[model samples]
Target: MAVKTVKILTDDIDGTEADETVAFSLDGKDYEMELSSDNAAALRNVLAPYVEKARRVTQPARTSAKPASRGKSESGLDIPAVRAWARSNGWPNLSDRGRIPREIQEAYIAAGN
Candidate 1:
């Protein structure tokens, strides 16, 4: 005997049939939601301004250990200090946790930290 399975996606907001799945990240966490085309378009339109101005953070390729360890072992720099400095220096989008971006790290080092 053979069996076939079907999966259906429902809009997270309006409870209608979803046309696609949208994936996004916020505050270092990733999320996915199914949405109809109209809702998806609306979401994109709402985020267009911020998205246009935002910097894209590409994660490094992973190995066996945690990604944060790579940043620490390579530089031996203080993460919290960098975060504090960034916040004080007008980097509003820097999150308190997770590996700091390489550009920020370079800036921190260049600033004599």
Candidate 2:
């Protein structure tokens, strides 16, 4: 016996069959949606002026596994040190891995550390 898998894309806006998936970003957030040709064209038309005027920024290539130095934030602060300070100061339940909350980062800086 043989089986085939079929994938269908429905337009996010109007529930019609989609021709393609559109990817966009706003306010530092990434988003993707399946859109029919008409809706996709409309979206492009609306954003054309802004897109023409906007500067394109290229993202760094990603690796499958994070490097050991990934703990450092974009601001170049030592994440391990921040975690240690947070744990000792007030955030005893802070996780050992993953991103540190923005509030904690701000507080760490505010405390002159």
Candidate 3:
């Protein structure tokens, strides 16, 4: 599934600060960093609260499910380029030349590559 939006909530239970006062902003916008500039350990007291809050968040739900179709996937039926050629040549509906589901015709053109 596509993630369209995100909501963030941070809490400080132990009066810890993740970063220095450099995190404060004008309109409730704050930046709390987990790693220091030198890639050293962060101040434990500061980051613990945000970490706990993060753990509370629920992950998004799973999306589409499809059962295994034996040999169908191996047939290359879902190949995007092959599908494009078939659709472009009036496979969905037979043209006046009456080529429908133009897989074999497409293979002749593309040599089934």
Best by lDDT: 2
Tens digit per residue, CA lDDT, model 3, 3-69: 7785333223233432322242224465553333222234445666865776354558876885664
Choose 2 or 3, whichever is better by lDDT: 2
Per-residue CA lDDT of candidate 1, range 36-87, in tens? 9999999999999999999988888878964556335267987778888888
Q: Pairs clashing in candidate 1?
A: none
Cα lDDT of model 2 by residue, 19-110, tens digit: 99999999999999999999999999999999999999998988899557766887788999999999989988889988889989998999
What TM-score do all the candidates reach, one by one? 0.53, 0.60, 0.20
Residue 45's lDDT within candidate 3 is 57
Relative to the unseen true structure, what is the C-alpha lDDT of residue 23 in candidate 3, on a scale of 0 to 100?
A: 48
Candidate 3: TM-score? 0.20
User: Would you list the C-alpha lDDT of every candidate in the order shown?
Assistant: 0.87, 0.93, 0.46
Residue range with the least summed lDDT across 10 consecutive positions in model 3: 17-26
Ranking by lDDT: 2, 1, 3
> Which residue window of length 10 is worst by lDDT in model 1?
65-74
